[model samples]
Target: MAGIPHYYLYGEPGAGVDRDLLHIEPVRDRSGPNDWRIRPHAHPDHMQVMLVADGGGTIRMEDRTLAVPSPGVLVIPAGIVHQIDFDPGTDGHVITAALPCLAAAGAQDPALGRAAGQAAAYPLDGSGVDVAAAIEAFRSLQREFLWAAPGRRAAIIAQFSRILVLILRLSLIHRAPAIGAADHDLLVRYRALVEAQFRSHHPPAHYAALLAVTPARLNAACKARAGRTASDILHDRLVVEAKRYLIYTESSVAQVAHLTGFEDPAYFNRFFTRRVGCAPGAFRRQAAES
Candidate 1:
């Protein structure tokens, strides 16, 4: 397959957006020009959050497609391939922040990191007032971004953090009960370790050693929180990167295997096919065709 496009945003090339802190804009400003359809692309160091106030449509992230309705939130993490098709006349706000900025924020609140660590959609439920308040927060963010008033930068950061916290609250309400704090911390740290060292091909035992926990304990934490074994979590991370490389780069299957941490191309092919239901070459071809 040929290279899939990478962009900073919809029209903005990845290299052109130099701001490392944040960028806020309305959805229509970018999507309007493209007939409201954003093609599949990946951002190397930015994470995006979209709050849908009025209309909605489908979001394609990696291999999963999600339907988002009005009064919803979608967070796209760095390095994930994603596309969005908005309904005509859709109205909403989109914020693209440097992944480092998010990482800094997450340092203060690890839950925030988990919420934004992947592509997720949260459709707001409850009284109209709750939804209206979330929309107002988006408008407030936009105003501060435009006016650039005194202390505007701080205000923007604060408002953005508030929005994330609010969404976290809503997500928790609709999802399963929270896990134990100790277990949750271990799980979060495990995920962080996997993100940083997946390319190095470290085993789950290495991660457990780094986290000062036994392999059984790490597996238990992962199972309690994500319903997956620690080894499965590690393998899933590798598979995700494999799919990204296959879809976005012009690299050959052997090169992709090497890049994703497999020294032997044959083993990589078998691993990918077992987890992704197709060989790397076929996955690339399918992404190109779709």
Candidate 2:
């Protein structure tokens, strides 16, 4: 593995975009130039929301590759290593917003925040959402993003928030009815905590403590909402991050172990093999070959 490219936008290498708050453009504007294939990359401080209006392809986030449905929405959180292969002439809009902008929006609505943080695809065909209205919203957002009019920043935020709220609704509609609101909310908070602390290798009890709940309560909530125990959620997050490091960095296996919070390289190797069915070195070699 070599160093993965970190870009402000897909192919643009820079600290940040000029607009700073948000950037909107047709998917073809960037993907078309690269033959509709975006290689694996990460944006350190930006998240992306892509609306695929026509055509479809596959998106790879870390080790998982999922097909993109036409007339769907895709969310990519900041700092995630992802790639997208779009069908030629795929028509859609991609919205790139700064982390601060998302944070501000999330401060107002936690559900929206959670939805944005997750990387997912929501097909709008049978989602009960007004597809035409959603497209109009994207167009309005792109217009505001391009114009140098007064109150441009606020308008962009407003439009972005609207899209997020729509995504949230779609997520809720698709979510299992078995999970109650309180359990869902707790799961959301638990996920947020995992994202922040996964690299530290903390136990579930540590997270439960931070969330002001007992470990049993946290585990139950996680089981109800995510179909995993709280410990599983934490360990799964750790494994995902470990896979990212192995696939994206040229660090030695031992170094990768320490970087992912393991003190003993042998222990890390055993852990990786147990969960992933291969040693870290083998995993990296396989990824490179693929």
Candidate 3:
């Protein structure tokens, strides 16, 4: 009960995954080492990486306290309530990526999120880069993000993906499912379009019009292969995106409400609350206050 964090979920997400990358922040919290006991936290759509830089600490994952030290990487799956804080004399750095994006890139294929368990937090390349180098790299990327460097954003994304590959190779013993070459080009095209427009327009019909597929046929293909309706997939993606924004961003509830395509703040409040069981402001406040 010493150093756990808190999390808040935003919606009842449907099956099928969405890829949205979020904030890459670095924590060098020596000051809060004594005062920073994060209560157990959970979010429905996020997995995180905790890289320690200094001071050793205890991480309570579900019902356990795994010892974490500098140059150590802790992988936490989304939807599990866990907490981490100073073990006694250690301060550390953590890098958190949205689960959807890591799920898309980390594996040799997609679907790793559902398959890969929490143990995926071990070394990157047999634990890549040793502890010291990885810490430097993580810090470098965090610094670049803070600077808001011009072309560095894309570079950081690439580096982050590469880091995930290393973690996957070491952590998951199973190979990923392959995407075969078949008559699914149109479906692939539709998926790409949906990824780009999910935050702006989540209506499956909007994507169906873009892909020149009748709504019925689109739904059939999606449900058959992905076991989800096209509209459900769209909402799942949008909800995941909204959660990412809320967690990693300092944006206000109203700003987040508008950015996620909600026209009325009241409507957004009702929408997310209906699914997640809490108001938007309450979610943000709880997330920040933690």
Candidate 4:
């Protein structure tokens, strides 16, 4: 499959830059000359935060387009296809940070890592401090990133983490049927485990053992946080990877099956059919045609 352009911020695609670094700027700086519109694109391993002070527009994420008004925040997680159009004269600060930076900062705290993985957009509450703090955080980041003074990089990274904390707090405050801390943590752990072991086709019990939790407890957490069981989570992850392979590669069905952890093509076909509502070949054909 064809690849989307990769860049360090809004600069030219494929520019050589440190993978663990970040770029900070105002939305107007980049969007002004381009009619305030950005076409759909994917960032391979970068995360973005935008603090809009006034004005608004729409966002395109995958197959959905969302209306976004000003006085809000936008969090774009890594690897998602997204695009944004700013209203003319919109005012905002955009903070683009490398995923590795957040990962390193959160190495000892799984909750922080989990927060960095969320993608969302919503208007800030009028009486809340989140919007103000978020805007100032990005401004500080931009100054530190540009000044290159003593410990500039360290200061910028610290500001990045601080911004993430504020955003996560805001998310919790605004999300409905708020997730309990324990349930959120468990779901994050499950997602991380799935990322590491989905290729192995490990059972839910295996994941629970690795997490040092009982399978029943894990299932409870998944059901509480996501309305799905742990087993369903694992199966869904497997099917997602399988669909990606089938759509993006020239691999045959058997090859795709093996690559996605099914050694038996027939079994893989059935699994895909059950979860994805179609056979693998048919899925591939439909995706290609679309």
lDDT of 1: 0.76
For residue 10, give model 1's deviation from the true position in Å: 1.8
Candidate 3 lDDT over residue span 1-290, tens digit each: 12323332222232332225544544444226436566555543455666666566676755456666455566665545566676554555555556456645454545343333343334333343455566666676677656756776466666666556445554554232222222133444555577667778657887878878788888876654344578776777667666767877888777888999988878777878876668777766776795
RMSD of each: 13.1, 13.5, 11.7, 12.9
RMSD of 4: 12.9
Show the lowest summed lDDT stretch of 10 residues, model 1.
176-185
Candidate 2 lDDT for residue 276: 81
Q: Residue 156 CA error for candidate 4 (Å)?
A: 1.0
Task: Decide which is better by TM-score, 2 or 3.
Answer: 2
Residue 263 error, candidate 2, Å: 38
Q: Per-model C-alpha lDDT, please? A: 0.76, 0.79, 0.57, 0.73
For 29-138, candidate 4 gives per-residue lDDT tens digits of 88888899876665544677888887899987555666765788877765456778888988788877765566655665666666666666767766375566667777
Candidate 4: where are CA atoms >4 Å away? 1-6, 176-290
Residue-pair clash count for candidate 1 = 0
Where does the lowest 10-residue lDDT sum fall in candidate 3?
174-183
lDDT of 4 at 264: 91
Give a tens-digit lDDT track for model 2, residues 118-215. 77777889999999999899999999988989888678889989998987887787761221245555776777777666778888999889999999
lDDT of 1 by residue, 1-290 (tens): 02656566766775534344678889888888889998877665467888888789898876677887678888776656678899987879998887545665566687877777646777875623388788888889899888858887678778888777765676666562332246655876787888789889888899999999999999887765555688887887788678768876899999999999899999999999998788889889987896
